[model samples]
Target: MATMPSSEACSMALAMAAVEKGTGDDRGMETLQYSGWRCHRKIHARRPAGGMMPAVRRVPAHGSWQRTRGVMVASQFITQLAFTLGLPFLPLYLQQLGVHDPQRAALWAGASATFSGLAMALMAPIWGRLADRVGRKAMVLRATFAGVLVVGGMALVQGPVALLALRLLQGLLTGTVSASNTLVADSVPKNKLGSSMALMQTAVFAGAAGGPLIGGVIADRFGYRWPFGATAALLLLSGLLVLLGSREEFKPQARTQPSRSERRARTRQIWLLLGPIIVVNFLDQLAGSVVGPVLPLVIAHLAGGQQSGVATLTGTILGSVAVSASIGALIAGRLTGRWPPPQVVAACAGGAAVFALLQGLASSVLLLGVFRVIMGLFIGGTLPAANVLLGNLVPPQDRGVAFGLTASATSLGFAAGPLLGALLVHVGLRAPFLLTSGLLALECLWMVWSSRRLNSASG
Candidate 1:
């Protein structure tokens, strides 16, 4: 038996003893006495006044997370699809709008893209911090609905400047992906995080792949404006889905401020994990976008300068690569569920680098397409693995900030890639591809070395 205390402890313990012995009719009375004794014990122990204990809050499990994921995925799919669908034809639209100079057209298009990315990069972290305070689902819903309005309004813009301004606004408002990632980190069990993140990556890539094909067809048949109109409608519908289908359940943390040392430790941890992710983002975007803005021109040149047919062929190449990538993402997701994320990421990076290098070596259009398809497969798996690795590294409370930082890194890489590709085109058409491939190879080495270090530390 446990030892009982003397007179003071007995008085402190009497109420609890009475409650233990009390019947249903006497339970309330004994509970009240127990509260009084608890207060007394607190005073004796020199604890905070009132002796009130904070309630243990239970976080929502699979069901809530899954529902939020579904809504978020739907919203992302539609908005991203709409945005990507119009991207391939934006320069063409600019040219048609009286900016016939190729240099000017390219400059304007690049500026619009840069502005959009800058807006997103600047706003993502702010929105993320807000989500942590208010509620993630609410922020997601707001972003989705705001995207609907901004993108839909983009259809009515009369000039390139107006379009660029709207695009910037759209980026500032739409942060659904970042919020969704944070929600998943909070709601999903640790064991299933890799698979869930993989599924998210698949959705993003699949949307990206399908959008261009559909947009190209629409642009070829209907008009440039028609594609934007269609995209706007889709975004509106997606926003509705998010508003109707999603629910937010906020759980606030205990109110305790961190010390300077604790804050420094956390900051160090964040930078340590963030460094590799930033590198991965840069390399991934560099590899993907190095071939992007110029692929149509490449196809046109290959097809003996038939610019009219380039859109269709470019769409075909993009779609083919995306299909391969989707399959790779699914496979990687399953594999990573069983394997460590860093190992999977390193393998994917190495494979993508080899295929990207082969892209620069292709002597025929058929061979280039084949290499691109292979590259897509490997590249498709990289983002999912990176996200899963991040999910594992960060704590739930800080996940929103971590995801926002990642979004910023990705946006920066994306913003820079097209410009780099354009600049390299001055040297040679294949220079960008070769350079990106080399960078990717370096990234692969980094991943391998980092994974080894992580393993050694863990062991």
Candidate 2:
């Protein structure tokens, strides 16, 4: 799956833009100037009334925010790296946890993953709404600290049952990326929101692409348990960084709750954006998850059932996809710059659909990897496109909840994906890929139709 960008990147980009503008020398600041200009122009066009925040007001805040953003990006990168380090070995881990039978191990993996997704899906929205009230920084801190505890707890668990419980708890407590994104979205100038969001997305993909390769090496040399302990330590550091380094200027919504009619109207508006974006996010993840539980096994079967280096190979495959996705995200950011988000979204969804189907038809491991890499490139673009649209669609105050709701959709898809994958495996290993491709095709069609309706309405 593609990584969500941290809020830190947005803030960092904004601060750099501020610095570049003040200097006005154009000596070696093309990147900063481009980002700043992109954000400033877009935000100004959308919100002409706000004009620009005065330089005097923008400077001091930008300085503080920039430093915090730097720390946050570092911390988030480490956190993502740590979490994915051993995640590809979950089925193997389950086997070690006493599920000796291959089918049983697969089922347990799906169940554990499903429980975590279910728990996260249920809680994410509440936490998101809470962030709006308590502040996004607070929400992120909460997720990080809780992440340390739950992931660390995984190291101590001895059985599938215990591990499943810890995974479930992990979902409930850890949404650091989402919270951070919400905070960053709120902090940056509206005009630059798209660029800021794009940068954050790229940062996430970079970390995700690199983390698994290292994690695989570590897992092979050390053991599965070491990764969990290491993950906890990283989360603790991430939490400390956020608590000490990040700053936010959150303005709580009106104290009085909205009337029922107003609430209904707001909810309706939220769905207009949420409907397609959430569906896209869900479908994308569902497609990914369908293959997630059994990919290692599939690879092993393709490699003539070589069990010795399966973990490393699994990491290699997963890492390739992430690396390709990162490249795709960069391309998507540019595409969004030129075309409407919906058009970009349609293109990405369609590409992913075609590639996912090809993956199902692959007869060899090398071909599957090739299809996966190509699919990752397409899937990676979907989020940045959909995300920018969401950022534009939702009002500033509602972003935390909006992202939270997106997270919920993601969790629900993740929850269902493994279970579906497990079921498909019973039929045949390649079946999941076909199922995924079909789902993505339907999602693509719906998104195209919806975007056209939205465009026509707005026009």
Candidate 3:
């Protein structure tokens, strides 16, 4: 009697044949065992012979990275400008609307931010799923246009309740950064992902640095509403560019339902990979939040009752750091080739923690501002490294969800920061900064540990 081929051998043979045929064989031979040989042949034969060859997709070239970077940067600049313009003035707006108690004003402000975060957290995953089904570019357009409408409405609203409601709406719709990240992940090659993400992050930091300064100026002169209106126009323009100028490449593929065992295995893998990323983001945000809202107050106190230039001084301190952050991002972008992302992140986080500790001890506005700039440099490097790591770890098919989870985590941190700052203020003005520095130290430890584990596994 002739010995028959084992099931595993049979599957491997079919897979090899399919691969050789180049047509319908694009699906890995791993699927043949479950689907059976005849079904596999039929499915594999339907694919064009040339389809098995790597499809040539257009991506940003090294030369064109600058131009693509410009588009994404401009979009982030306007979006952040809108976000930051409202940040300083929102408390004052609540005060004007009959919230007499300082605690209430702070509470209202915190609630508005919290609701926005909750909305973003809930909607981001849905949007990510949609982006994968549709295209990331299309999602970018949606986010931009929706931001214009929701943020513009904030200018026209009559009361704090309305403003809060509008902010909630804004969070539900405004996912431009998340979409932009998805686009970058899709377009940039793995080797170049770190630099590309860093450049994109610089746009974010630049916008954040400028937004508060511009908002303060507009609020000082034309009132708060004008800043919102200006932001609305900029957002509209950004949306139009994404909708018209950018192109997305998506290859259509037949979807198949996975077996229960396969689904469970994939879920386990995703959780294992995603868990550390989420923890890193949470710690980073928590530390940042510990100081973010209190920074302006710290500057004012350091100025010794000189409230005349508080807004300007605050804007200057924040903007100066942002400028430094942008520079750091640019430098990190270039260094991605020489240094691995985890090392860069750990080093940056360590430096940022040191700066945070220094800021806690500073007695003058100048000292605080100088330290902030240094802190910005470190913080600026973290995002790109995190993004690049995510891009490398997750498969392209699942990138949308990966990025969406990241966006949601960051938003949650953003929302939580002010509240944490507000709470810490009850103890003392400088307390939050010191606390933040401690948290960052812990985060640095985590980063180092996680990085080593990942590297060891890969090695």
* Candidate achieving the largest lDDT: 2
What is candidate 1's lDDT per residue for 72-176, written digit by digit as tens?
667667766776777776667777666775546655666676677778888888887777777777776777678767877766778887888887897788866
Task: Give all candidates' CA lDDT scores.
Answer: 0.70, 0.75, 0.71
Which candidate do you rate higher for TM-score, 1 or 3?
A: 3
Considering TM-score, which of the candidate structures 1 and 2 is the better prediction for this target? Answer: 2
- Candidate 1's error at 191, in angstroms? 1.6
Which scores better on lDDT, 1 or 2?
Answer: 2
Off by over 4 Å in 1: 1-59, 453-459
Q: Tell me the alpha-carbon RMSD of every candidate.
A: 8.9, 8.1, 6.8
TM-score of each: 0.84, 0.85, 0.84
C-alpha lDDT (0 to 100) for residue 68 of candidate 1: 73
For model 2, residues 17-78, the per-residue Cα lDDT tens digits are 33333344545233322122112321111112334422111322567666656666777777
